[model samples]
Target: MENLNIDLLKKIVSTYSPAGNETRICQLIKKEVEPYADEIYTDALGNLIVRKKGTGKKVLLAGHMDQIALMVTYVDDKGFLRFTNIGGISPAVTYSQRVIFENGTIGVIGCEKIDSLKDLTLDKLFIDIGATSKEEAEERVSIGDVCVYYSEVIVDDRHMIAPALDDRIGCYIMIEILKTMKSSKNDIYFVFTVQEEVGTRGAKTAGYAIEPDVAISFDVTATGDTPKARPMAVQLGHGPAVKVKDNSILCHPKVKNLMIDNAKKHSIPYQLEVLEFGGTDSGAIHLTRSGVPSGVLSIPTRYIHSTCEMVSLSDVKQTINLSIKILEEEI
Candidate 1:
């Protein structure tokens, strides 16, 4: 955990990049890896692909740069901004949280303070940005501006908690791994894809363009170890979770086994991830061009799709180690 760059990770998770609007977070990622990459560019859909070439096999490693957020859909006569969830969001977790706009405007989100707890819905939520009238709110923010729940990265004991760590932690892993690897036999393509929170969209295009011999994606998977959870096997502080199955795709067995073998060989702890509800960038990568062999290395995350997602720093460090070990191999 000490080896990981907390500063960079914090900056990334803090940036507001809802599904279709991922420019700011993408820019933050580009700045971190631009010098290490041989080629860095954005695709038609604004996915940032950073290529670091080698000679053996083409390997594409993708982590999406977007986070779950809300979009300013309408404004009330009283200047309150009405928003729609931009991605799969938990209404229970988002209530009464502060959110920030792209233009540096700040607001507080409230879901109609109620006496009883079970009566809230997205329809009840509204953002108050301190505007006096509808025209005043419109002047500060437009109809399309996106807002991310405001949160700061905090390191407690051995875990890091912040908003958007689901994939930003994955994004951090990709960025750091590329910088750490000096040489390799594979032509490594590190792509910071967009719109993963909405659907595996950006990686679908970037994966097609690269058409690599192998694909590995870094993202987060839900853990059922939390209290009242619906029974999952993964736990925090365990090493990186290797995706075996999820709602979207059955991971390539060879790739998954290779990752597990590498982790054991290097004494890195890992857990088998079976997410009944979500997917990752590998979902798209596995579907590219006549089918590429792909797998995902995931972090066991808690309170996912919320403003304060938590992941073990130890798991994150192990993920970095396991990925680099895989990249250094011939297969």
Candidate 2:
């Protein structure tokens, strides 16, 4: 779409914000949303909450800003850094990949001699920062230092391939919605949450604080489009998906139906998502005090949690349209 901001999407996706370390990206989002929001603030767990004042129902919209990463744990005598995963990092997808730390230090992942691919595991892998000794490696990195995949975003006519698209795409959609919104009757709380890759921790706090009438989370969902991939109903370029159920929470029927009805009423293309093994911020938000109803709008994604996660630009645009429709109406 002509209105899609590719630069903004790249900036948000390239920012280094792994789980529990979201300050850099949080600042970027705050600046972008300040003019559009009536009030904005960060919570105890670093969730960036922007509020658009209204007299109607209080609606909370969440999109996590964190990405999966690796944390340095121990350094070997030969100057290699052994680390553990910060989130759901598969050893198969992570082998021999490049990673960048916060201070701009780049490192390459290597693993010990293994019999076969099946023998590959996180414990056998280490990071090499071109250090010759343990002291040298310590000079560049330290224990508990986090790093994310080092990959540049590639955008074409209809698709985007990049790292951290899992939730950054969701953040991008929310920002665009705020920029384009004219007026609304609901008091909308747009929260760019943190630590979702680990356990949806930020949403737990944000949902409790807002205590909204209904909640909706925006995140990426796995697709079945790839060759020999798992048999999922979602696919790229098919528009956004309204969540029915996932591993963590069954979407509240009212919220699910609202999203579906809005898409139909507006003639916006959408698919019904039943994710077999993942969760979104709504997983935690729905369980807030007194049990608030919550649902999710998922962008169909491929190669999730890898260096080159892919999503359809058209699907993203449609997701934004469907989200705007839901927010503009009574929920």
Candidate 3:
């Protein structure tokens, strides 16, 4: 198996490309994939589409670039920023965390006095940027400005823990695949999508435009390996999970079987994933024009949506190997 590019993964995950604000991350990805792509362009919705032309089939691979964030709604008189959730943010996991705005303004999340932990909510939270008053806060941040969880990527001998790994790790996988894939007969479209954290918006648009014969999405899935966690079959360090079903879409049998067969043929480690909740870009891509067949490859992730989501290095490598096998062969 090929080695996982830890540096590349760290670089991509570190960028603050929250939903509706993907230009910076898109540019970074566009640069990384340009050399390997036959043609590259950005769609109206800011989805970075890189094509490797072929005549066998039009295959679309989507991995969203956007991460969950907080959008400022009001600035209090005392210079604290009140915000609303941009995606599926848990107040329990968000409190006392730090956030960084696009312009480099850093702030700490604070909450009002509450009687109990159950009473904690986003409404009670505020961001302190060290501003003395509303006017001062407005100078650095404005209504509608978004901020992402501020955290650093931590790499161990066998695992990676970082912020925004939900889909950024997916983006990193796609980028690596584009760079290392030797050749293919399918006209492949590698899309670094935006706003997936919100509603799979970018994939929906990109799918319509490409209208590929087959589609696959890369994203993270929750695990049951942690202490007394949900009873999920997936675990880190085992392998990639081939999607069977999720809340948003059912995996097409052909695509799902194709992944399983490829993994078996190549002796690649893999697991079956049936997420009881949550979804991926495949949810939107499969619903495209004429209803394209689609499936997903999920990395077993622990503590998803938290500041330090974790994935195994071995699992990442196996995912890349299986993905390459799927793309290099017939659809």
Candidate 4:
């Protein structure tokens, strides 16, 4: 499958771009996408919009660039940095992991572990930077400094594992599709939006700005295939998951059918995704202006919002191919 540019994908995932602090990653994306896009610019809220113009129709494809992380809330007398969540995060999985601050200082997230399962909570977690006093810890990393689980992309057995795969993989898919398309039928807007982990806030503003006739969101959704979790309609390695419905928006049937039919015609592997909780940028885009025909193209993911999320390389490739085909179709 042409190797799918593993080096570029790894680089994007490894770069730290947590919610509200996406300047560096956005700059990297701007450098990579400038030659291929007809126009590219950043909105006031830091959403990077790359456009490819055509006369057929206006279509918006959005994938959030932000990943779930933590914000430092309090520093204790013992020099432990206490943090509250900046987005939806599982404190259980984040415990005892090395984290990098926005300023590049390093620390370890430590939570009080106990034999009883009920004792595990976010309130019990704190970061230790080896400082004996709060003054020392504050000097290294401030009270407002943001932190994300420090992990790098590792490719093994045709799968990529790392933090922030939930949407960074989506970002990679959008950029690759923008790079490889031979011809375009629609005026495509490829947006790498911000603050999705917090509340899909960036998308609401950006969607309003574009007011696209059609919209599609590329992001990762949790797989039910994992052990003892909530039942989900997606599974890892199955293929790209087309959204039927999620917590926020019910996908437009015509758009969903178009995606499914395109996948079938091209013989691309795909599955239906019914997310029991959470949402994608499609949620915000669907309600834009008078309303737009919108749906989602999702990659099945495991350990979402944790330090080590996983996705199949094959699934991501399929997502890119399918998106390109859909954009090229006469609609």
Candidate 5:
């Protein structure tokens, strides 16, 4: 954590910023970007938009700040907590995991009797806060409180494992670019969007308001390097990836090629991504305002959408470099 940017990245990954509850993480972004941004504001949808002004084509770079979590739905008589998942959380990954609410309330996740794995669902899941009875539980937590996966970021020399990297890595790279970007001719909007995990909601509004001529979303994509993983051309430690296609949008050829060329020109290691499922902010951004050409630079990630997501530090560094290269040049 010697790198100031890396240290900020670790904190962003560890912070709880579940969908619809991104205020805390958004504040962190605001403080970090204020020094370098020409203008900054939060939109009606809670997207944090920062501006670096210039006199060329507008560029939008979005990274969602939301993560999957659970909400307290019902308090059972025996002091157990019945909850509904906020975003796409796998039951397999939630079992026995510690989840924390905004007020620092911690609970251990557990599940009801399941005859088989197919019987598994959010309805069968519960959270235990060690309350003696329903009354005590109500005193501690009430319906409508959200809880995020509770885990500390673990860092090795080359990799980081933690929750919320799905898009915190995006936030990190955007902040680094803002901090260290060279003089640029194109106007840039850095948006830390909300509610992307639930849907690309924030990006849609921000995109229309900014109406960028071109956009590049910073997000993570799956890698197939793990044991028996799905076959993907991208892999962790291979460097950042330029998006070709994903479930949401096909990257614009002109933008994608420019990213590829920038990486090659600068000697930044990179890969091409073809994700069959899952979408990022670019999915919505490209469709805004008469179709802005869009692309994505993804940090190769493993165990995505799970509590213990993993990413390569080298890939992240390369992404920052490549983004600066692309943003500084006239487009």
Candidate 6:
């Protein structure tokens, strides 16, 4: 079990699991959770559910398994691959980056000749697989195949960089909580959700199916500490963030307070998040059934949605402690 911590995180980020295609990452997570979970199942929407037996309150913990990706739309006679985004993506960042498909196909994303910077868009982008013609490109890559940023996880000092830390880091937090948790009376359901980048669709389905007493989502939030970044309070290396509000939903007062209290009681570093845009699984989970009180534990991340997403391992460790504290206590 030496170096197991980073190993787990590296595995999560290294796996390919875009919005609708999460089987690969889920398969890796399922193996790790089986030893600690009372029962495990994958729902129709591809959400991986890991249940731990408890007799008191039902607590649902969610972390998405999907990342933003690109889908091949067409292949030209010259062996160029046209694509459309599978989730919210920035065309500004797509130029000159490599992408990998599920079937191990590798291609370099390139852009069409543009007259001006204003004309640069996703439509102007195409992936080149070095094939000589359309027939060769089609043989290796077909329309509808998805690919994510080609990056690997790296750990240096307390910093971790990867392509999909947007939520895989959240998954790592969940896995650690499942392993370190002691005796508790809460019925904990740790669900590795799917298609969050697309629309939080997996969370909506998982929330309806579980309908737990309380829910907490683990996901990454943007940081404003970087030079000339947006005006936001969250910062990398500060601590995990307690969600107050985001674009999609206003966090329930009680659930938000619970997180604040847990962080204080456990002496865990934390921050308050009021993200002006973007949303998490909690945004959808809180609306399921009559309603479910929910909040988010955010890992402050830099350059979110980019190939080199950065996070502090210190903040990540604190997020794990806070999540464990919440799950071990009754609501």
* Model 2 misplaced regions, further than 4 Å: none
Which pairs in model 6 have colliding backbones?
A: none
Candidate 5 per-residue lDDT, tens place, 36-128, comes to 999999999999999999999999999999999899999989899998887788988898899998989899998888889898887888999
What is the Cα-based lDDT of residue 141 in candidate 6? 91
Estimated TM-score for each candidate: 0.96, 0.99, 0.99, 0.97, 0.98, 0.98
Task: Encode model 2's per-residue lDDT on 1-331: one tens digit a residue.
Answer: 2469999999999999999999999999999989998999999899999999999999999999999999999998999999999999999889899999999999999999999998999999999999999999999899999999999899998999999998999999999999987778999999999999999999999999999999999999999888999898998998899999999999999999999999999999999999999899999999999998999999999999999999999999999998988899977
Model 4's TM-score against the true structure: 0.97
lDDT of each: 0.87, 0.94, 0.93, 0.89, 0.91, 0.91
Best by lDDT: 2
Instruction: Show where candidate 3 strays beyond 4 Å.
Output: none
lDDT of 4 by residue, 228-312 (tens): 8788778888889999999989999989999999999999999999888899988988887899999999999998888788999
On the 0 to 100 scale, the lDDT of residue 280 in model 5 is: 92
Relative to the true structure, candidate 1 has a C-alpha RMSD (angstroms) of 1.6
Candidate 6 local Cα displacement, residue 97, angstroms: 0.3
What 10-residue stretch in candidate 5 is worst by lDDT? 1-10
Worst 10 residues of 4 by lDDT: 111-120
Query: What is the per-residue lDDT of model 3 for residues 1-331, given as tens digits with 9 covering 90 to 100?
Result: 5677788888899998899999889988888888898999999999999999998999999999999999999998999999999889999999999999999999999999999998999999999999999999999999999999999899988999999998988898898888888888999999999999899999999999999999999999999888999899999998999999999999999999999999999999999998999999999999988999999999999989989999998988888889999889967
**TM-score, prediction 3:** 0.99
Task: Name the candidate, 2 or 4, with the larger lDDT value.
Answer: 2
True-vs-predicted CA distance for residue 107, candidate 4, Å:
1.0
Once model 1 is optimally superposed onto the true structure by TM-score, how far is the C-alpha of residue 286 displaced, in angstroms?
A: 1.0
